[model samples]
Target: MNARIEADAAFTDWMQHVQAGMEGTLDAYLPAVTEIPARLHQAMRYTALDGGKRVRPLLVYAAGELFEAPEELLGRAAAAVEMIHVYSLVHDDMPCMDDDALRRGKPTVHVRYDEPTALLVGDALQAQAFAVLSGNVEEQYAARQLKMLHLLAQAAGSTGMCGGQAIDLASVGMTLSLAELEQMHRLKTGALLRAAILLGACSGKHLTVVEQAALEAYSCPISLAFQVVDDILDATADSATLGKTAGKDAADNKPTYVSILGLSESQALAEKLRNDAHKALEQFGNKARRLHELADLIVQRKA
Candidate 1:
């Protein structure tokens, strides 16, 4: 595996640029701090604006940039995807789900506020996300934008992230094969990551079948590598660094790549996945540099 590092100042600068743009958009979409339903709106803003890596939005911008997509469309597309991601995290930390108390180095929604407020916050964000993506766009890209909405909806519904979380809840304390584990993560983690790429690409123009197939190739391994790294971090990193409970997977008896494959093999698998992601993007050459850098970040991330 190449494992090349783009550790230059430029890489950090680009990441901040994307993060800042999406962060500002999110703040704008959220209800005002003193809205009529002030408490619910406050909970929503608290979770959405608190802090996160915003990796999914970055992927949207990067892939859209590949086809010279319109900045207006791309910005909306990124914001919509990020809203869904934030909603998922809000519910995931609720009492019925992972029941986490801390997230992103702060109190989880349900922890900081009451449980009912947290529930409504998640529900509102999910609804608001689709509202952002429902408008018309460039004539040539109109159909593609609709397709992006469907992709995100399906990714969030029973067949995608929600379905994967169901599997996760059901599989606790039960043994699973590597293939089964991959299936779970594919829906849970991979679906959103893949949608980010497709939604971004769709924001620009229609991709030839061959070009989209290449994006799929890149997204599959890239998504899996991300989860593998998460598993590794859960085992090795601290709560302060991770911004969440460390070693919670083992404590909950949840199955993870590291749990089944051991630390050494999981690390090796992450490297292999990164290599596959790069190989899939070889056709795009320098145009895919952001994606290639993202794949490396997913695997090499410490938290």
Candidate 2:
């Protein structure tokens, strides 16, 4: 095989390993179905376990591996970030939000269970994420772990994902400039993704100001590109391919890259962002191979 094919195979192996390992890690960290609130616990597992691309956790592992972070620490951080991501999805699918009935090819939490259970599931998962991240903190890494916790909270709270989501709700049926759309997604979609990378890097050691800046620059384009590709997929792909309702954004009349830039332009924008993501990692060289591949995957994925 060619070198490109070799690298793709290696990355496929690594991706499978991480995905499988996260299943066990999350299962162990989550509350048991037999826990006091059995129904709520079951719902939490239903929404969180065994679904989706797990891109956030994959980013966590890739960044963590780049920094030579400990495997155990990386696992905790990965599971924590994924829990937060899943919680956001749960809430986003509620009638109060997107009102979707399917996610990851399964009935949404609110659809499978009741609205109240879904709400509690999201709440419980968020709390569980912090609990897992905060548990078993070593004295040597206490300060660093504390910072990780703070970063996650900031990412999930107002001024981050929640703020972006609020803007999305209001933007329906309204026209927004490209700059405005970028700003909203920066918080809603990019914040947690940025946090996933930073949290993984922080797990290994302290980051120099320069290193942090480079990582920040790299994250900016990749994060936005992820959303750009999502817009493209939503516009063109089917629900079976996407594992969720397709054309929902257009159906809801939400402003998207496709709506604003046209399908071809939106696709070109995604490619440009992917290139930007690669350029930002030039300084990191081969150490960022996984990150480079991830950037490609984000833009090139069919769903």
Clashing pairs in 1: none
Q: Write the per-residue lDDT of candidate 2 for residues 1-303, one digit (tens) a residue.
A: 599899999999989999999999999999888888888989999989989798999999988877888877888899999999999999999998999999999999989999999999999899999999998857887887899899999999999999999999999999999999999999999999999999999898778888889889889999999999999999999999999999999999999999999999988998999998899888888999988999998998998
- Per-candidate Cα RMSD to the true structure, in Å, reads 2.2, 0.9
lDDT of 2 at 293: 92
Model 1 per-residue lDDT at 173: 96
Model 1, C-alpha of 254: deviation from truth (Å):
0.4
lDDT scores of the candidates, listed in order: 0.90, 0.92
Error of model 2, residue 140, in angstroms: 0.8
User: Against the correct fold, how does model 2 do in TM-score?
Assistant: 0.98
Superposed model 2: Cα runs more than 4 Å off? none
